[model samples]
Target: MTHKKLILHVSLATLSGLMIFAPVATIPAQASSVKPSSAMLKKSNSYYKKHYKAIAKKYKFTYSAQTGLNKSGTIYVYEKTKSSYLKKSLSLAMNYWNSKLGRQAIKVGSKKYHTVTFSVSNAKASKSDDSDAWWIPSTKKVQIRNSLYADDLSVITNTTLYNSEKSLVKTANANLAAYKAGLSTTDPDYQSKLDTYQQQQVDYAKAAFDNQESNLKSGLAIKAREFEYANTLAHEFGHVMGLKHSPNKSDLMYWASGTNDIYNYNKVKNSSKGFSLVTSTDVARAKLAVKVHNARN
Candidate 1:
């Protein structure tokens, strides 16, 4: 089957075939050179350090005073709250685009920052009455609800059941360690156990996906909130990149924001073999946007 059709088919199944796992990229060699601005307030700098430091190093871009939050050339990730998910999600979203669209040079900040500024609001403030997140095209700012800090996916990943799913994630690491100990010389039952663990891992992932969806729909604990928020940021960023929602529900830019498809925020996070990042269609459009943008400027 064609690649696009395959994705649609997999997405339609809900949880039958797992999406292919993309190998996580290694941190850039000189991770220390990219220092974020201390002036930008955040809940913790650790998220920037651990998740975004590498991207900053690789891209080496910052907010442009020239553009002045014009949503042209360079995009700034302003943090409205101290939510770690917000920080990580914005950084990941930017990095995802940077990979596809090519990086832009920045004129401000220390080394290069994601451009964060916390907005304190005591009153209940959200993008709209019906939405959890939205990107304001005119303001050139991405506003996320402050509640994102508390109702996040990490809550699930830190729990016992979540740890079992995590173990499935670590199974490859375990097998690698065993092979390093001496492949053929390793414990004979290890391979059998690894196989069993692998299957159990898939089962756990499927179960986790279902449970997370139910939780999302029923207003229960958010099982994959971090991943969902990251996807949300990516989706909105697609708007910022001058792209519209796709008719294909499997695409990240699907119009309904994953309400009915496998790309549903919860399902994609749980069912994607590993890191549920944006889809190929999203990347392609972003690349086109960047190309047209660069040509005009």
Candidate 2:
């Protein structure tokens, strides 16, 4: 008898896979001319030299002094995407950082001064699965996946639901001891009671997950998409400013697309206080990077 060959196929999907491309470029040698001097630059350099490691430890983002700024203390950004909406998004990101740093450290300019280039394309090219955008440190380029603009919101919805379920599972696991406190394995009905209790927990979790998913898919759907795009752009811009992934879930530079950040933005987008997508730590780090770059140049 001949046996047929067996085959198996597996598929995996993710919400967002924003990543920083490798091969970090070396910092060029500084010119022999007089080093630029300013009060903010001096303070930034002093603060960074003293507390960067502590800041990194606290904020969980890798530090680098790789600013794309020119000798005039401006990093020119060229928008090759040619989309007004994207331009606006880029402006928002630039303005947010400038406001935080109290300087025009970044600018929109011609290709000659364009150390940082922004573009949008539908082609996946070298991107990984579910990647929304990426930053190349070596070339200082950012490419946003155009497909995200027209996405159906299913990805964000599913990720939100999955996170909710995972949180519920964690809570259940933590309460397992309490769940078995009054039950004895020697009793004939113990297994049934335990199973019923577990099932009730599962049912409650399911209901909560369903409610969150529904809310995300309905009233918050559009805002969710908008937040994702804006956050992704800002996150890539963070990379441009020499910041790596942040471990804090609420930060825009968080490793993935930051569903928590997205949720927070949606909640406070219309608030009087407004939402700060970039955390204080992010601002501090970027300011240090700019100061270092300027000092060196």
Candidate 3:
């Protein structure tokens, strides 16, 4: 299969009050037959063919020494489940990467989709972090939870909007502190000012809360099926490719959307043709990773 060069355009606002937009980069096509190590391919292909006839028939199984990641060497898609949205979501995610990289080694298998549940570690297990998907480094396998869906991402998006609104309220409260301190029982307009300020805070908080709910119901509902699901799927796969989390929020490798709230909202706003746009930083790192592997070998 032929693949076009990956190109990404990004805008950056500099400290000097100038917005700098990076030029689009066109990377040349790589050779088609960059095969993976035979030993790993033999084992992975055997596992797929023995258990998943559908997968064996559909995808080419190969390994890539350039990536130093055996997982991407062969793409194994679990059988389609009863949930059609989920099946489509997974397919879109897989296709997004494959088309961009020109890697068509995919296999559709009958193996049940994988899931990871968090069991209480001990008596003091009040806090638990459950993952929808994970990439196991040792085994080089990507495990996707059974509950993956488009609407599920609303939790994160809503939380971010909620926090941004809270930040606004906090700032308003800080501004009111001086006015509150100067108040006295003798003052005529003191009560009215206090009442107005309090009302303003209340109104601000309510507005923020309402926007959060509205965005979740409206914006996220539409985006989840289109770009968000594809973005999420690609993020998980980046981990499987041995990529560490990137500091840049726009990059697929960024793991902490909650802490960097504004970027989460911006991501939903700036999606490319039914999917999140992969940034130049992501492509550069991926190339560097492959280059590093080649240099070492």
- Please report, in order, the local distance difference test score of every candidate based on alpha carbons: 0.43, 0.58, 0.44
TM-score of each prediction: 0.43, 0.54, 0.41
* Number of clashing residue pairs, candidate 3: 3
TM-score for candidate 1, residues paired by index: 0.43
> Distance from true position, residue 211, model 1, in Å?
15
Which residue segments of model 3 deviate by more than 4 Å?
Answer: 1-131, 134-143, 148-154, 174-187, 218-229, 239-285, 288-297
> Could you say which candidate leads in lDDT?
2
Model 1 per-residue lDDT tens digits across residues 92-202: 555555665456422222224543232322335323232445554434455555553343333333332343444545765575566556535367887776567666656
Off by over 4 Å in 1: 1-72, 102-128, 147-223, 258-274
lDDT-superior candidate, 1 or 3: 3
- Cα deviation in Å at residue 131, candidate 3? 4.5
For model 3, the run of ten residues with the poorest summed lDDT: 1-10
**Model 2 / residue 107 / CA error / Å:** 1.9
Pairs that collide, model 1: 153-225
For model 2, residues 167-237, the per-residue Cα lDDT tens digits are 87888766666879878879999989888988888888778777776777674545555555555677777
Query: Per-residue error at 168 for model 2, in Å?
Result: 21
- lDDT per residue for candidate 3 within 4-112, as digits (tens), equals 1111111222111211111122212222322224332334433544543232122221113123143334445553346555455566666766666556533444455
